[model samples]
Target: ASHAEGTPGQAVAKAASAATPLAAAGGANHGARAMPGNALPPYPEAAREDGLEGLVRLAVEVDAQGRVSAVRWDARSGVMLLDIAARDAVRLWRFEPARQDGQAVASTVRVALQFRLDAPVGWVAQADTR
Candidate 1:
């Protein structure tokens, strides 16, 4: 069943297939990329209804010792308040440093930050220990 001419759903499938590469290309041009082929969990209805909308793309420079040496904006969200907050928060984030070939290498990352103007999810484990 495709939607092209007499097809029932082939158009939908084709459109979806075409979109993947285009999205990756678009993100690539931004010097960072979204996660590959991983379907993130769908947003909850509460988050949608509460106007919780914020996403910031970051480019982190990984040092030789697998540490974040610096972070910069790959894409800005237009909201200075949110952007500053996200930048500040991302500095505290830890990650498995990127590698090229075999040795640890510096790489940029694109991350999304979604904020919920709702209840807290509780204390962060590392922060609790500290």
Candidate 2:
């Protein structure tokens, strides 16, 4: 399933376990998961005014402390405004750190952010994985 297709403010986050086969195999290792109640990235006002909409794919690194350690784009939304907004917003997000043998570990997770003009202001839909 494609993560790009979704309602505005509805993001789909998926954890890629390429680096950790155990996580992919559903073993004791687990990938970092997004915590509930994290704020959605605010739509860029100028982009909204211009009716811009696109999906941004990001690879976010979550540390053992559940904080975002780094973020890099896996795919860009084309619009600089939208891309920057998504990146900045994800930076403030916290996650449940990946677990390895019952111990916390840092891991990378992929996030898909969709921007739409028709979405209700200040409302973020619940996130799901695809």
Candidate 3:
């Protein structure tokens, strides 16, 4: 739950619910979705050495083109490494692009990525709509 300052590793959070929504606008009616095969950021070795683990909440802006236009740290895992890892990985992610009136529209959404030692690498990311 806590780590020393300046520790290096990927931020993570509690397990996420399945079938989470990506955006609040249009609710589940929007067709935007994350494309498969998104490459998860590698766990920071420094953080791993310290046995650090926590969740990283990120606010991501997906452009109408489905490209990740920007990312901001909404919440940190108390480890700098983890926050950096989550921010870096989520940036490269591609989405289906949110739709409004059947047209692609830019939208902002929050996601929680979990980092746990027991979980397989890159398997802990979940879309958190809240």
- The best candidate in terms of lDDT: 2
The full ranking of all candidates by TM-score, starting with the best, is: 3, 2, 1
**Relative to the unseen true structure, what is the C-alpha lDDT of residue 18 in candidate 1, on a scale of 0 to 100?**
16
Candidate 1 lDDT for residue 96:
45
The residue-by-residue lDDT of candidate 3 on 1-130, one tens digit each, is 2333233443222233234343444454464466765666667788788898878888888888989888998889999998898899889988777676667788765667766655533333333321
Cα miss at 86, model 1 (Å)? Answer: 0.8
Query: lDDT of each structure?
Result: 0.39, 0.67, 0.65
Candidate 3 residue pairs in backbone clash:
9-81, 9-82, 10-82, 11-82, 12-54, 12-55, 12-56, 13-55, 13-114
Model 1 agreement with the true structure over 4-89: per-residue lDDT tens digits: 33221111111111122223344222121222222222223444465554455656564545455677877676655556665675
Better of 1 and 2 by TM-score: 2
Query: Where does candidate 3 stray beyond 4 Å?
Result: 1-28, 121-130
TM-score (all chains, Cα) for each model: 0.46, 0.72, 0.73
| TM-score comparison, 2 vs 3, better candidate | 3
Candidate maximizing TM-score: 3
Model 2 regions lying over 4 Å from their true place? 1-27, 120-130
